[model samples]
Target: MKNLKQLELLEDVLENSSIILPITINGKRRSEIEVAKDTSKNEIIALAKEATSKWLEEKSIIKEIYVPNKLVNLVVK
Candidate 1:
């Protein structure tokens, strides 16, 4: 779950910006995924799940995810 600060930031972006591709990080690797501003919350979650799939085999689960400055920080366990 996002903290208050992260929720606020995400809300700001969702309300004020156009579609974008955010940077996603997993461990030391990073990638980008395009997401439309009008995208549904479920879709966003699905995308995140897909992005983090490679780490699941290692028994990792997503710990945190936030869009800061349009960059997606996806931390895993």
Candidate 2:
């Protein structure tokens, strides 16, 4: 995913995958929803998309969905 310097774009991907990505902002994950990319962005985004697609396609598999607490949404306020 291209860094927007703000990560809101990841919201959809995270929602669809039902998984939180762990990001290192200021050295710690704001919650636990940060995506890890060790190589080219193209490769990383593709990987994330692939994983999410697989999770969606596997209808029988149950994935855990974690909703961030209210406090986590307070940073902008």
Candidate 3:
């Protein structure tokens, strides 16, 4: 978010590439004891499942951007 111009340019390109993002909790783990102390590992995974659904919901907005129809590979060295 520090570079607004870069984010705008990225919005122009890439588009829906990151439809599913990496699970990241930046702050103090939201008191893990409450989140999943008594639950099974499967229950712990449920949190991520819910987050994915939320990400998908937000991804819909980005999908409507005006972008080129064809794909062009960038030459990276």
Which structure among the candidates has the greatest lDDT? 1
**Candidate-wise lDDT, in order:** 0.61, 0.35, 0.34
In model 3, which residue pairs have backbone atoms overlapping below 3 Å?
none
* Residue 33 of model 2, lDDT score: 31
Worst window of 10 by summed lDDT in candidate 3: 66-75
Residue-level lDDT of model 1, residues 1-77, one tens digit each, is: 55988999988977876555453556454555667676665566567667757654565555556553355556665
Which model scores highest in TM-score? 1
lDDT of 2 by residue, 39-73 (tens): 34444434433444433353432223222321111
TM-score of each predicted structure versus truth: 0.48, 0.24, 0.25
Model 3 bad stretches (over 4 Å): 1-34, 56-77
Instruction: Kindly report which residue pairs in candidate 1 clash with one another.
Output: none
> Residue 5, candidate 2: how far off, in angstroms?
37
Model 2 segments more than 4 A misplaced: 1-38, 54-77
Could you give the candidate ranking by lDDT, starting with the highest? 1, 2, 3
Clashes in model 2: which pairs? 21-33, 21-34, 22-34, 23-34
lDDT of 3 by residue, 1-77 (tens): 66998998888666534222123232112211123223444544444445434333434221111112221111111
The local distance difference test score of model 2 is 0.35
